[model samples]
Target: MKENGIYGLIAEFEEPDQVLAAARQARAAGYRRVEAYTPYLVEDLAEELGMHNTGVPLICLLCGITGGLGGYGMEYFAAAIHYPINVGGRPLHSWPAFIPITFELTVLFAALGTVIGMLILNGLPRPHHPVFETPFFEQRNQSHFYLCIEAKDPLFDRTITQEFLLKQKPAHVWEVLA
Candidate 1:
């Protein structure tokens, strides 16, 4: 279905098993830029397609640590240096008093960082994707599954990819146009 310049090749499947098998086969063929669209969740599909660890957790942890340190630092500066109001002759640099705010800030920054990191990693805020251009893309909501191997994949070649998808025996293979 090469209507114009190719973005990639998309294979439509009638069943989850078919798409899953196709994905596994694609991975075995060394296709790294494969993606799958299904009406419902398909177990192990992500793993089969080679989706794995990302940096979101690391980002969250770093943000949490920074927030905890910042919160503690702010309180320390205010109590020990900026204000230093001695309450009941208690220590002005009381670290125990800073625990609550530090904990809150750590949780807050970690949550915010997780949300932001996920959005960025997923390439969110986009209004369109080339797969949407497929005339049959809407079928994805009605029990169809689609697998796409993007042109950006190092192993991608239009003819070769199309033939490869054809070998999977999909319902039909379409060229996803950019």
Candidate 2:
């Protein structure tokens, strides 16, 4: 354990199975604030962490609806109320003509919502994090798998958490400092 402030205790594993097992054990032991890092996606990892649901779909839906309405509203006001011009003898509020712009705006807003919502939800734009303080953490980009139990967890105790992590038989364990 670190003499100073601690962010968490991270266990390094050589295989995805080890990380998965450690995460499962941590959860079973009533540790809620846990996270894992790996070079690639591990099947069932998110389920083990209980992190399935996300709000991105709902955000995209609402944004797409708003964009469609705004697009139609803009065209309606411009062609019918603001500048009334009978082009090609069509009706002032031509539904077919509005379809193209509305569709485009719906797609654009949905894409934007996906990007913005992901950034916001994932807490992006963070150039650095305390987890980087762990030794050999940079190796996560290669073959290593990591499981971290945060100090902020309600059930966290330095000695007990470290002992629990040790029972998982990790290759290395380190105290992540803030």
Give the best candidate by TM-score. 2
Q: Which stretches of candidate 1 lie over 4 Å from their true place?
A: 1-4, 139-142
Q: Lowest-scoring 10 consecutive residues by lDDT in candidate 2?
A: 1-10
List model 1 lDDT by residue over 53-170, tens digit each: 7688999999999999999999999999999998999999998989999999999999999999899998998988888998768755477899999888888888889899999999
Q: What is candidate 2's lDDT per residue for 8-87, written digit by digit as tens?
A: 88999999999999999999999999999888999999789878877889999999998999999999999999999988
Give the lowest summed-lDDT range of ten residues in model 1: 1-10
The backbone clash count of each candidate, in order, is: 0, 0
Q: Which residue pairs show backbone clashes in model 2?
A: none
Instruction: Write down the TM-score for model 2.
Output: 0.92
Could you tell me every candidate's TM-score relative to the true structure?
0.87, 0.92
lDDT of 1: 0.89
* Model 2: residues with Cα > 4 Å off, grouped in runs: 1-4
lDDT of 2: 0.90
